[model samples]
Structures are given as structure tokens and as C-alpha cells.
Target chain A: MAKQIVKALDGAAAVAEAMRQIDPDVVAAYPITPQTAIVQTFSQFVADGLVGTEFIPVESEHAAMSACVGAAAAGGRVMTATAANGLALMWEVVYIAASMRLPIVMSVVNRALSAPLNIHCDHSDSMGARDSGWIQIFSENPQEAYDNTIQAIRIAEHPDVLLPVMSMQDGFITGHGVERVEVLEDQAVKDFIGEYTPKYSLLDIDNPKTFGAWAFYDYYFEFKRQQTEALSKVPKVVEEVGQEYGKLTGRYYGLFDPFEMDDAEIAIVVLSSAAGTARTVVRKLRKEGVKIGLLKPRLYRPFPGKEIVELLKDVKVVGVMDRSIAFGSIEGCGPLYLDICASFFTYGNGKAPKVVDYIFGLGGRDILPEQIEGMVRELIHIAETGEVKQVVGYLGLR
Target chain B: MGELIEIRWHGRGGQGVVTAGEILAEAAMEEGKYFQAFPDYGPERMGAPIRAYTRISDSPIEIHSQITSPDIVIVVDPTLIGLVNVAEGIKEGGVILLNTPASPQEMRQKLGLAGKGVKVFTIDASEIAMKHLGRNIPNTPMLGALIKATNLVSLESVIRLTEERLGAKLREEAVKANIAALKEAYEKVQEG
Candidate 1:
């Protein structure tokens, strides 16, 4: 509700600005391409006395995440950023951070895992960590990147959902692209994400709490069930935090962002930056008298299946676009498509849309508006004919 | 929903092509216009050909992809003209602004775009940079020629933005020289 400041910043810079406002107690980070700017910018803020947070330039992403887990377990608000191989290196600690219930926020600039090396945008990195017990949220542009980064803190630190959260933006596309972002006043952000009050801490010698302790069959299953219960509480907390943030910033968020879906007969579901491109095409198709819409998932983990089914129940044919392929799956479909299939199966009461999978934009390949338009036309044909073509197809593959 | 102008820049890794696009986007922002600017990112190796893109519009831009068909193309490194297809995917009636001492007609012939309904503009940006800034960084001067080719952003806003953004990094005289080169390129750019 305060006066906002407009600045031209890339997704990384916007996130760093949010971090500066959050001013966590500790930021243990290792530099990696695309994500490096976030660490670099935040480090400068630390050096310049703009923020009182302790900035640690760790040796590697693994060490960086380990340090975050340690700091967070010690009851200090913690944060970090990395991409691709860096995230892969932190694979072990990522799960530990979540299972240990340490709410450390991280910025994941989504990059393709390397074999034939690439330093470009893709969802493979984050999608690989979908079941890591950490809450995941994706951003479409710098504005969402900033907003989501700020909200990730609240979501992760909520008492009902004491879990780590990774906020994601597409590498090079959103991470490096410059656009206008209306940043909140520093005091407004500080007031919004108030002091981090931990009920128990490693530093609390009087009331000791054992963390990362080995749990055998006697208690392990119970701990896992507890984690599931905690995660089940996230959607409510996310809604409340998002609503409060909306009141402050006038940008309300939900489990997913649906565009023109109320009366649509054909639609597409996507995530992250590609959603922006799909939305553009959906607008064009709507102009041509086609009832098409798009659903962009802002939250990926604890997949909002029932809500998504409700949104797409009326649409005749729906296409699910995935930026990362789920290797060895049905037709080697992308991860998002598999999730959509599961959502429909579990939640659809015989009202499921004719869903198709589109694996696209892997390793930072561009998904143009025309390519999306072609998919929309295909969806129209499928709607009219009542015959599904291939369940999974690669979009714009050479 | 309103008109969107997309511009693509061709240059080497060390030519500040990305910064030039950012500067233009920032200038557009100053005019209360929405814009997106980014490089076709890759491993940054000096002298390796690279591209950057910028889009400006009256409304918000939701699409985040490479600019396939650019309305304006600025070749910051003249040597890249032969090594790269500088005019590929250019729209008809689009403008190609090259930083070369050669005439626009010569560039049109070299690019094989002669009589293709695409306008070509040329300026000795390197010469302008060397004359004023005592350096061969033609990015700023090419921006001036871009303004002459397409009045997407005001010349004054570009100069002011250049001064503000570059002033923090370079000496005051260097910033002034860069502005001078920009003005000269704006005055001397030739269209064919």
C-alpha cells in the first residue's frame, strides 16, 4: 500500500533486491552462471552495509547448501542461490534441509543439467527436485521473481509448513532479461516479512532439540507422515500469505494463474516463462473466436491437482506443456505432463479434459508464439474430432 | 496490445552489445514504455559472434523468447556482416543499421537485401567512437544511428540515460565523449 519504486532489473537482480529487503541472518552462497548475479549482487549489498546479513561465499553449491542447513537449524534465517550442476551438487543437502524442517529459502535459476554442456534455460534442474519435500514456486518474469522470492520466505517459514522453498525463474530468459519491476519500499517489505521467531533452536541449550537424528523403523514412518501432513498445510498458508501480500502490493497469487479459462473449451497448461508465450498465443486464438485459455502453475510442489482439475473441467481438450522431459516415461513425456495426468486421474470425476503432453524448450530452446499457436490449432482439431493423436509430442523439435 | 517494436543487435562478445540493448530498454522505461532486453546468452568468448534483443511496447510484454523476426537490426561489428547472416529473419520495410564507413547501398549489396523492401542505414560508428571517445567501442554510436533509423526512443533520453548509466563506470570526459559520438552518429547516419 506504500509508494512503490520502479526500476529496470533482470530477474536475478530483482531477486537480490528482495533478498536485500528480507535481510536474512545468513546467506551462504556459491556462484554459478545465471544465478551468480544474485549471489554477486547480494554480496555487494552485504559489503556496502545495505543489509546486516552475514554473507558467506562458499566453495561449492554443496557446501553452500550445507551451510544454509546448518545456519537454519541454528535458528537463523538463511538463503542461497544456484543452478543446474550447482543444484545437482546440492542434491543431498536439499532433501536434508527439508526433512530436517529447516526453512531455508533458495533461488533456483533453472538451467539444463550438463552432459553435452549447456548454460541455458530449462526446468530439468528444478523438476528433478520435485519430490525433495521442498515447496517449489515458478516465476514468469522479473516482477514475479521478486514477488515470489519475498513470498517464499513467508511460505517456508510458516509454522504449519516449516519447509525449505525454492523460487525458480528460467535461466537467461527471465534470469538475465531486463524489464521494469516495481519494487516495494524497503520498510514495507521489512514490515511484511517480520522477525523470524523460532520455537526451538540449536542455540537453545535450556530446551535442547535434536535435529537430523537417525530414526529407525520405530519412528521413521511416523516422521515421514508428519512431513506429509506439514506439506498438506502449505496451500492454505500460501493462500493466506499471498492474500496479505496482495493487499500490500495489489498483486494477488493463488496455487495457479488461470487466464480466460472460465468459458474456454480448449486450453493449455504450462509453467514458468513459457506460460508467458502460451498466454500471448491464447490471446490471439481468442481473437479468432477460439475458446482457448492457459493455466500457469505458480506453485509446483504439493501439486495443486484438485484446484487445477476444477479450473480445466469445462475445457474440452487441454494440452500440458513441459520444459523438461521425464526420461523413460510414457512416450518419454515431460514431468509436467505426467503430473497433469495424475491430477486428472485422481481428481476428475469423469469430467477430465482430453489432455495431451508437449515436451518443449529443453536446454533453453525458444518456444515461439507461432509454435504455441500451432498447438492451439491442434487442440481445436482434437476437440472437434474427439480423437486424440499422440499423447506426448515434442514441440518445435528439429 | 499496442504496437511492439523488436530490435536485434549483432556483435562480438566483448562489444557491449548486451549493454547497448539494456540502455535502449532503460531509455524506453524512462518514457513510460514497457520493454524487455536480453542477450542470446552463451559461453562468453572474446571475438565470438553474439546477439542481443530488445522489445518496446505500449503495453506489458509477456513473451520471453529470442526475437526471431526483428523489425530493426543493428550490426555493431562490421566484420560480422560477412561471417554472420546479419539480415536473417528481418521483416520487410525493416531497417538494418550498420556501424561501417561503407555506404548503405554497399551494405545492402553485401547483405543480398538490395531491392528487398528493407531499408539499410550506415554510419562510421567506429570512426565516430575513435574521434570522440578515444576508443573503438561503437555500441553507443550505433545506438545513435538506431534512433535516426527508428525514432523508438528520443535522442535526448538516450543521451541522458547513457550519461547516467555510463557515468558511474567511466570518467566524466569519457561519458561526454560517448555522448558526442552518439550525437555525431545521429547526424551522420545515411539511409539507403
Candidate 2:
């Protein structure tokens, strides 16, 4: 019930603690930057027999995820982690893991895709796979990385919610920062996140069911329907896990964590670790009597569009922070939300919040709090007079 | 509603810098505090520089995110001395604990810390690790010095975390050797 204090830890350590506490039966890992330390630490736990989890040292990310899929298919409580290019390598099998409905949890540290080839943090990698059937949760800090990782297994294994889940933190940002993160007691975590036995496992040799076999149109439609049906449980499962996690630890994790907008006239929405920087600015600007707030979207993929539109209903101005660049088009991830908000506005007959985009921190550049403050101020300025660029506000670009 | 204490770690790939950050966070969690630790990297390869961070808070933290500036910056490799701008974004009153034999004066000159008011401290952590642990990996030794330089956490905390993190065969020896390495560094550190 008590809290702990440590100097700092990065994203990799947060996931390792979750794995140790869960003590999965198998861990299939392939090395990649940012995500390497996580599997390495767990592999050590496996090597020393500290954990009874079967450690599978696979040769490649494709094989690493394939092994996890096999382990999960076999009904073994399995775990693993990979990022960026390694994830790209495993792209096909990832869909298999989801379609098969194996409740395997993995950590995906967000990294930029290569053209120029950068190792800094960005959303391009994850955004590319947005349509893949995994329940994705983006964490803004180390604490969330730990808690959400633990929650992923719980949410994924729920009989009503048997789909793969991936919790992502910015590669090298939340992934590598050393902050004091609260780790629940092994028993508490185990208690909070119960055993992860799958509903149907490949290990049931007696059951003798065909899996990963080809399905024609006759069975394909139903399977696809079932896949869609499983996804329908995500919102409820999120609510359930957030409730239980809140009961166990006092933190509330959800679709959105809005700040300073109780009665604010203008607001900003942000995601990932960058929200921390935005919050500091919101606090300072709020003290100056600025009517600005922050709407942070934690659940990115299963776009909580209506929920977000409702949250923005009364607000006059909204500034969306995109930690990525869309390049060649004005439509990066942030603009997708604008589309949702716009539809809601159309429903309200042109009575919705005025929307704009603020792209910042591409390639993991440092975005200062004052910059977020300035973005919100500019949004408020636009709201007061209704004159701002359609393509507006890219922070941290000199 | 409670505030959090955020920390960040920076080092190279081969160095145990990320390990040190995780072990420290684990130690604090053992103390029954709300804490989390993690690392940040992109291209996973040897010789590449890396960073790790942690957060300890009094209440539930919904905003799972990355740390920007850290309260304590732990440098485990001397090579990082040139590769990283290590002291950037460290809090005003924060301390920089490095694993080098250079004095605070020599380090300030070499590290170009003439203007910044942040405290600079160092310990021969690699030398200490080589002597005590018989390995070039200086994570534990620098962590020892870090615990000393900034009493952000206790030596017992570090040992507890070390035990939780280290392999059993090496656990006892590691606890003894690394703790000793920390004490050696702590005693040698100055507020210069």
C-alpha cells in the first residue's frame, strides 16, 4: 500500500519490472535499440533461475514474435518486447498474433522510420501499423510504462478481450529517462494482474483443433466478424483495468487525461511523453489567468473520437500537438483527430471547436514548456479573432 | 495530484548505465515508494550512446511519459564525456556525478562547465569497478558514486536493488563489491 522512491529509470527498466513480477512462462526476444534492455534484463532473470519463465532467445524479431505466437498458441503464459525496425520485420506475424486472438503483451518503443535514418523518437513506426488489430496504449511517463505494461496482460487475457496489446513509449525518451517509478509489490501486481491462461491453447493436444490454417470466404467473414467483435471489448476492458489499477494504485489511466479545462475557453490535446512538457506550460499559463487546458489522448488507436469531441464541445479553440511530421501532406496522426472533431462539428451544424495542428519534436527534438504555452496562446488568439493559418504551429523547428 | 521526482541516465551501449538506472528504481520500489524506470534508444547497436530515466511520485501517475531534464545525471563512461552533452536540462540545483578520475576543477575545464552553477562531482568509478568487480562495466561503481553524490536514495536502497537485479552466484559478491565501490566513491566525492 505504501509508495517507493528511487533516483530514476528509463523505459526499458519499467517493462523489465513488469515481466519479473508477472514471471511469464516464456520470453522470446530479439535485440533492437531502446527495446533491447527490457529483454536483456528479463533474460538475466531467466538465466539465473530467479524467474521460472522459459526464456526463448530467438534469432530475429520475426522469429522472436513467431516464438511468442507459438508459445501463446500453445497456451503458455508468454511475453516479449521489440521496437521499430524489428517490429517492421515482424509485421506479418503480428497480424497473426492478433487474428489468432492470443493474449500476448509486448512493449513497442516508438522510433522514427528511416529515409534519412534517425534513431530519435517519433510516431511514424506505430502510426504505420495503426490498422493492425492490436490494442495500443501510449504512455507519457515511466510510471505509466510500468503500470500499463502490467495492465496489458490483464486486458489482453480477459475472456471478453482476447487480443494482443502493445504499450508504447517514445524510444529513448520515456524509454530511457530515469525517474522514480512506483512498482507494485510482486504479490500486489500478481494479485492485480491474475494468471494469463488463454481460453483456447495449442497445447490442448486432446482438443485437436486446426489453427493458422487457411480459411476461405465461407469461414473468413465470420472470423473477421469475430475479430471485430473482440475489438469491441477494448473500451470496456480499458475502463475495467483502469478501475482496478486505480483501486490498487491511486493512478487513473484512460482514454484521456484532461488538464486545466474545467471551465477554460481554449484547450490543447497531446499524447505520449511530450504531454509532460505541455502540462508544465499549462500550469504556468493557467496561473497567469489564461483560460487554457490540455486534453491528453492516452488511447490512440481505437480513436475515442466522440468522447474527445464531447470533451471539446464547449471549448472555442483546440491546438493538437503532433510529436511527428506528416511530410508531403497536412495529414499526420494529429489531423486524423481533427477529422473526427470536424465530423462531430458537422453534427452540431458548424458549432464545434475550431481546430489547428501543432507538429513538434520530430526526431526527438526537445520541446520546451514555453513553446506549448505559446501554442495555446496562439490558439486562444485565433479563437478571439478567428484568423489563423489552416496549416499552423510547428514547435521546435528553427 | 501529487508531484513526481523525475531522473534521467545517459551513457553508451556497452556500459551498464541503463542497468544502473533500473537497479536504482527497483531499490526505491523495494522501499515501498511509487516509482518507475526505463531506457530510451533508437538504433540498437554497440558503441551508440543511450539514456535512461525514472519517476517517483506520491500518487497515481496517469500521464505515462518521458523525462526531459533530470535531477541527477549519472555518467558511466569517460568516452561519453565527449559524445554526450550530459549536463543539458539538469535541474538548476542538481548534481552531475560522473565516473572519472578528473577533479571537479579539471572536469569543469574539460566539460566546459565554467558558467553553469550546477555542481560537478566525480569518482574513479571505472577504476574502482575494475579493482572490485573485475569487469570494465562501470554501471554499478558509478551508481555507487551516484548514491553518494546525491543522497536521492540510500546505499541500502542500492544494495537491495543490486541483490534483486544481480544473478545469485554473483549476487553476494556483487552486493559486497558494488556497495564497497559506492562507499569508495561516496567518500571521495566533493561539492566542488
Candidate 3:
């Protein structure tokens, strides 16, 4: 490993640095609050001539993704950034980019979708796109955001999984929060990602291939099946890329990061920035002789259900915290909770832990350490008494 | 985990409170400490009240919530005293630094913090800035006063880091004036 440079940077700036090192052929992006800093920083890099990238300032997130799709189809590496309603705006093309098998990576600074018009951290934006066939990776801090951004490029471009990827960081909380981040040298990053050579290109007139072709009724289902098969290969690619990155940086990653799960009676499952807050409480509780652990999901899409179930099997009571609500779905629980429940149902075979859902931190509400500790205490009560007073709960809620 | 120092900054929208917190965090990192700096983001219009936070420790910081109980509170805009409660959740034996022309005792009386058991320090950072830089930017000078009053980080690192960060966008004379303002505030801060 080359000597790492330590710097104080926010998640947005860190991801921008990663993008700079990758130096893709195209970066077509439209700015939105929280995520605007990312493209703004990258634009500076483009202006300073530090990167050899074609930076296109698009009109909207839809146009941005559309430009990315066009660029990638022409056999060029492309990337973009968006948040909240911007992701909602790109909803149509988001699926197109995935189904077309274009390996365009995006930095999703997660935010809450608006009727209230708030621009802050929440998972509702990405959760709404959970079925869009994009591989989603959640980051807990600026360091993880930097690492995951670099990893997403490899995961999306993998031959076995030519699917779009969304590397996420909580807006304002992680995106704007400045912290110490140790960055790999630019040359090392270049060496790690190497180069991207498309299998077939629209520009290859000699071997002319078609894309976005109409496949109705008979062929549409088969096309979706192929997409599903491609997604199934993501976990393996993610692991391999993570392992390679770890060898270079000494920070190994997996499907999920489990903290003190061994021989614990109770546990909390969460994602993104809140997981860091929950881990602090788990550590304090463990010191007080409370058998509690934390499982933070890193890869949200291609959801690692079987692996998550294996880790939570030994715990008696588990609380899954979600920052985005899946309205009217299974007692109106949050999306992450619903997925965790489905994972337990499909893989646990009647021996899964008693799973509960906690819908928390909606609309960028704060999730304090004390609030997390209270949730843990509730989990302890359920573990000791074997009675879940509440199946679905609200944390940090009025 | 070593002791963590949490600081809260209260200012208006354009007073550079957020940058002050960020610079302190960066300076702490230069001293081989871990730090986090962030602002309470909102629809920030000019002259609107805002707050920012900083946490520095020997180990990595995990908590992502706003600091409820800060060990130090720096008030960059004195007008915020009546508009906002500057000492809502300060810890016992904590310190409160203000950029004001009034002495610390007068500030304690005005804010009704006489018996709060917290240290109060005051520095006329605006005057220092105007004397040196011909402007009223108190954030940089207040940073120097914060270091002198708390010893959070070495003053040398703050100066070097500030010079390096500003040198990219500022002329040499402006950078030197900013440094002069910082040193003046460090020498002139008064404690109650």
C-alpha cells in the first residue's frame, strides 16, 4: 500500500476526491442541495485541469442520468450525483440505466422526498428506488463514503454484474459533516480500478448492436430474469472488490458490519449514519454486562438476507431501525425493517429471532445516542420477558 | 478513548461560524487527534441565527447527533445573546467565550450566568479584525482567542493552517493582516 494521505473532509468532498482519482470519461450531473457540494467540488477539479474528464452540466437529474446513459452506451465510463426529489425526478431513467446494463455509478446523498420541501438526511429517496435494479451501498461516515465510492465503480463494471450502482451517504449528517479521512494515493486508486473496456458499444458500427429495444409481453419477462441474474452476482463482486480494497487500505468490508454480536441476547439492525450512533450505545451497554450487539447493513440492494440471518440467529430479540417508511407495508413499518423481516422469514426456517421494526429519523430528524440506548433497553426487556409489547415502533418521534 | 472536547458556536448566517468549527477540527487533526465538525443546517438567510458544533478526541468519534452538552460555547455574534439562549446545555465547569467589547463580568450579568460555575471570557475580536484586516470578520480572531483561553490546540498550528488554507485564495497582505488579528486576539482576551 502506498502512503495514505490524511485529510479533514466531508463525505461529499471525499467522494468527489474518489471520482477525481477514477477520472471517468464523463461526469454529467445536475446539482441539488447537500449533493450540490459533490459536483461543485468535482467541477473545481475539472476547472483546475487536475482530471481529464468531460464534465457536462446538465439541466436536471433526469437529463443527468440520460446523458450518463448516452455516454455509457457510446462505450465511455460515466458518473453522476443526486438526492431526494432529484432521485425522484430521475426515477424513470434510473430503471433505464439499470436495465440497459450500463455500468454508470452515482453518488446518492440520501435525503427525504418532499411535500414539506426539506433538504436533509433520510433514506426515503433511495428506498423508493429499492426495486429499480441498482446496487445500493450505504456509508456510515466520510471514510466509508470515500471507500464505498471507489468500490462502487468496480462493482458496477464487473463483467458478471453489469448493473448500475448507487453509493449512498446521509445528506448533511455525513455529506456535510467534516471529519478525518485517510485517503489512498491517486496512483494506487488508478492501479486498483485499472481501466474499463466495454464488451459492445453503440459506436462500434462494424459490429452494430442495439439497445433500449422494445421487448413486450413474451420477451420482457425474460429480460427482467436476466437482470435479476445479474443482480444476484453483485454480492460476490462486492466481496471481491472489498477484499482487494482491504488488502490495499487495511479496512476490510463485507455485506454487513457486525459489532460485538458474539453470544449476545439482543441486537439492533440499522443502516447509514445512524449505525454509527447505535454502535456507540452498544459498546457502552456491553461494558455494563448487557448482551447486546449491532448489525449495520452496508449493501442494501442485492440485500444479503441469508448472511444477515446467520449473524442474528443467536440473538433473542432484534430491532431493525429504518430511516425511510414503506407506507402501508406490513404494519406500516420502514423499508429496511420490511426487508429484514422478509429475510428472516425466507431464510430463518422458524428459528429466526423475534424481529421488530422501528421507524425513526424521518425527514432528517436526529437520532440521538440516548434515544438509541432507550431502544436497546426495550430490546432487553423483550429478550428477558419474551413478550414484544410493540411489533412496530417509532424512535426519536414525538 | 481519550477525553473528547465538544464545542458549540453561535453566530449569524454569514459570520463564518461553520468555517470556524471546520478549521478547529482540521487543526486538531493536524495535532494527530480525531475530530468532527458540522453545522445545524437550515434555510439559512443572511443575519439568521445559526449554530455549529465541533468534537475532538484521541479516538474516532461515532456519535452523529448535535452536541447537547458542549464543554465550550463560542458566541461570535453578541446580538444572539438576547435572540438565542447561548448557554442552554453547557456542562458544569465549561467555558463560554464571547466576541464582545464588554468585560466577562458584564456579560455574565447580562446573560444571568453569574453563578453558573462556568468560566466566561471576552475578546474584542471585531476591533482586532478592523485594526488589522480593515474588516469585521471575527471568526478567525475568535479562533485564536479560543485556543489561548482553552489550549484546545497549539496556536502555532491554527496560524499555519489558517495561512495555508487562505493563501490559496487571498493575497499575501490580506493573509498577514488576518494572522496579525489572530495574534492580537490571543494576547488581549480577558477572563472573568
Candidate 4:
């Protein structure tokens, strides 16, 4: 195994370091809260000549994605970084980039959307883009952010799954918080990602091709179906790439990471940094002789429905904690909650646990261990009584 | 550091509170310990009150939340004592390190920390920084006091890591002066 060099870095800096190592052909980004450090640090690398990447300081997030699409379609390895409003601004291009099958890797520092103009951590930004056809992966800390960013390149460029990837970390929490991260050697990363050899490139004059070509009735549906088919392959590709990265770095990743779930009667399903807190709570509860556990999803887009159902089917009660709200939905739960419910409803063979939703940490509200403990206690109650008083609940709300 | 040691840093923007946390985290990393450092990022304007946090442990830190009940609180800006509740949610027997010209006893009285079971330490870190660096950036000096109060990491390691982190960006003279400030504050910090 290759030796790992551990350094203290924030999620943004870690992602920037990965980008420096990958040295993608193009990085077009606009500065935004929480995510600004990623481009700022990467641009410093460009100025210092550490990486030979063409850094484009675009005016808007939409323009940034547009530039990325143009570069990626030209057979270049392209990347970008953005947060809440920026991701919202790139709404049109975000879907287009995926539909065009451009392998653009984007770092989405997760932040809350604005009507109140708050710049704090939440899953709303990325969850809003969940149906936009991008492969979404969430990171718990700087280490995962670094590892995911590096692995995302290979996953995006995989021939069987040529799709854009959004590697997400919590805004401010992970983006600004510095932690110990083990970085692989540049040569190892370069070799792992190899090269981006576009099968159909606009730059390849010998084989003429048109990207984002207009398709009416018959072809548009087929193209959409093809995009859906491509998405179906992402889970396998993600796992394969994750295994390869684990072999090199010893930090393995799966669709979802289960902690202390072997004998857990009650579990909490969550994502990103909250999962870290949930794990800590699980340890505490386990010591207290409670069969509590946590399930943290690293891969969000492909949802990993069957795998998640399989994991939770044996549990008595499961609580789904979401950092973003799915407003106006029938259940009035968060996006992740809706997905988990949908998964159980579809694939559960009458062994599905009674799942409840807890919306927590929206707009960067702090979710303390005590709050998690309370949620677990509630889950235990649900398991004991075989009744859920409230299916959708809010945590840490006054 | 078998258990997690959470530290809350209170300072103003541009005072290097965030950088102090980063340098301390780097020193802890050098000691082969797991650590996390982060600022409560807000609309950053110079002189606006800011807060940063650090968590050092022998094992990996799994929780990612604001340090509500800190084991140690380091106040880099003396004026912030009245503006913000610097002692809010401090764990019982927690240590409070302040950069003030006042004596530890006087500071304890002024901050109303008497009989709180909280240990208070004081250092004229701003004066030390001004004497060494000719500026009021008390972050490095406060870091020195933090090491003296908590002994979370060695002073030598912190100075070395400071140089490593700031060497490329700062002038050689500034780096030397900052190191000197750290050493001076380490020796000068007084316990109440």
C-alpha cells in the first residue's frame, strides 16, 4: 500500500488539494459563501504553478457550469465548485451537463437556499438538484471530501457511467472546519484517474459530433431513457471505484456506512456531518445497553434503495434525519426521508421497519448529541409501543 | 488527550483567531493526534467579533458541531469580554485564558468568574505582541498562553508549526517576531 501523508485541512482545502493532484484540464467557478475557499485555494495552486489547470473565474454560477460543459464536451477533464444560490443558479446547466453525458466533477459545499438569505449548512441545495441527473455523493469530513473528490473523477469518466458528479460536504461545518486528512501521492492519484479519453468529442474533427443536439418527440424520450439507464449503472461504478480507492488508501466507501447495526433494533438514517454525530451517539447508547445504530448514506443520487431496504428490514424502528426539507410533499418530511420511505414502500417484503422523519439542522441549526440521544430514545419508544405518534417531526426547533 | 478537548477562541476578524486555531490544529497533527479547527464563518469584516473552535483528541473526532461547552476558552480580544459572554457554557472546572493587562484576580472579578470552579489565566498578550511584532495581533501570543494554561501541545511544536504555516506568506522578520511573541507570552501567562 502507498504511504499516506496526513495533514490538517478543511473540506474546501482538501478538495482543492485533490484537484491540484488530479490537475484537471479546466476549472470554471464563481466565488460563493462557504464554497469560495475551494476555488480560491485551487486558483492559488494555478498561480503558483502547482497544477497546470486552466482556471476560469466566471461571472455567475450558470456561466461557470456553461464553461465547464463547453470544456468537457471538447474532450477536457473539467471541474467546478459552488454552494446554495450558486447551485440554484446553475439549475438549467446542471441537468444539461448530465444529459449531455459530460463528465464534469463539481464540489457542492452544501448550504441552505435563500429567501431569508442565510449562508449556512443544509442539504436543500443539493437535494433540490437530486432529480437533475447528477451522481451525488456526500462527505462527513475533510478526509472523505478528499477521497470522494479523487474517486469522483474515475466514477464520472467511467465508460459505463459517463455522468457528472456532485461531491457534497456541509457548508461551513466541513468547508471551513479543518481536520486531519490523509492525502495520497500525486502520482498515485494521477495514475488512478488515468486520462479522460472522450468517446465523442467536439474537438475530434475526424469524427463529427453534436452535443446537446435538439431532439423532438421520439428521440427526446429515448435520450431521457438513455440518461436514466446511465444513472442505473452509477451505484456499481461507485462501489467499484470505491473499492479501488480503498485498496490504495485503506479508507473504503460504500453506498451507505452502517455503524453498530448488527444487533440494532432502532436506527437513524442520515447523511454528511450529522452522521458523525449520530455515530458518537450510537456508541454512547450501545454502552448503555441500547440496540441503537446509525446508517449514513455516502451515495445519495442513486439512492441505493435496495441496499438500504435490505439493511433496515430487520430493524424494528428507523428514524430518517434530514438536513433539508421537502416542502409541499405529501408526508411533509425532508427529501432523504421521502426517499427512504419510497424505498421501503417499493422494495420492502413486509419486513419494513416503521420509519419516522426528523428534520434537523436546516439553515445550520446545531444538532447536538443530546438531540440525537433524544431521537434515539424516541425511536426506542416507537419500537416498544409499535406506534409512531408523529411520522414527521422537527429536531432542535423551539 | 484521551478524551476530546474542545477549545473556543474569541477574537475579532483579522485578529488571526482562525489562524491560531489552524496553527494549533497543525501542531496537534504533528504530535500524531487527531484534531479539528474551524471558524464560525459569518460575514467577515475587519474588527467584527468572531469565534473559532478546535477539538483535539487521541482518536478521530466524529462530531461536527459548534463547541457549546468548551473545555477551554481563549479570549484574544479583551474588549470582547463585555460584548460577548466569553464564559458561556464553559464546562465546570474549565480553564479561561484571557489576553488582558489586568491581573488574573482582577480579571476574575471583572468577568464575575468567582467561585465558578473555573480556572482563570491572564496575560498581556496584546502588549507582548506589540513589543515583539509591533502590531496588536494577539492570536499567536494568545496561543502561547493557551499552551501554558492547558498544555494541549508543546510551545516548541506550536512555534515550529507557526513558522511552517506562515513562513511562505509572511516576511522572515515578521515570522521571527511572532515566534518571539509566542515564547514571551508562554512565560508571562499568570494563573489566578
For residues A161-259, what per-residue lDDT tens digits would candidate 3 score against the true structure? 999999999999999999999999999999998899999899999999999999889799999999999999998989999999999999998899999
Index of the highest-DockQ prediction: 3
The candidates' interface RMSDs, in order, read 0.6, 5.3, 0.5, 0.7
Report the C-alpha lDDT of model 2 over B2-79, residue by residue, as the tens digit.
266677777778777667777776676656666666667556577688877766665544334456667767777787
Candidates in descending lDDT order: 4, 3, 1, 2
Residue pairs of candidate 3 with colliding backbone atoms: none
lDDT (tens digit, per residue) of candidate 3 on B40-137: 99898988999999999999899899899899999998888888999889888899999999999999998788888899999999889889988787
The local lDDT score (0 to 100) that residue A173 gets in candidate 3 is 96
| For every candidate, C-alpha RMSD to the true structure in Å | 1.3, 5.2, 1.3, 1.3
Regions of model 3 farther than 4 Å from truth = none
> How would you encode candidate 1's per-residue C-alpha lDDT over A1-398 as one tens digit per residue?
76788899999999999999999999999999989999999999999999999998889999999999989989999999999999999999999999999999999999999987999989999999998999999999999999999999999999999999999999989899999999999999999999999867999999998989999999999888988999999999988999999999998988999999989998899999999988988898889898888899998998988898888888899899999888898888898888888988899986687989888998988999999888888888899998997998778899
TM-score of chain A of 4: 0.99
Judge candidate 1 at residue B110 and give its lDDT.
90
Runs of candidate 1 with Cα error greater than 4 angstroms are none
Q: Given candidate 1, what's the lDDT at residue A42?
A: 96
Cand. 3 Cα-lDDT: 0.92
The residue ranges of model 4 lying beyond 4 angstroms of the native Cα positions read none
Note the clash tally of each candidate.
0, 56, 0, 0
Error of 2 at A104 (Å): 2.2
| Model 2: CA > 4 A from native | A1-9, A216-219, A326-350, B1-192
Per-residue accuracy of model 4 over A1-398 as CA lDDT, tens digit each: 78889988899999999999999999999999899999999999999999989999999999999999999999999999999999999999999999999999999999999988999999999999999999999999999999999999999999999999999999989998999999999999999999789899898998998888998996999999999999999999999999989999899888889988888899899999999988988998899899888899999998899999888889999999999888998668898888888898889975688999999998999999999898888898999999899999889999
DockQ of each candidate's interface versus the true one?
A: 0.86, 0.27, 0.88, 0.87
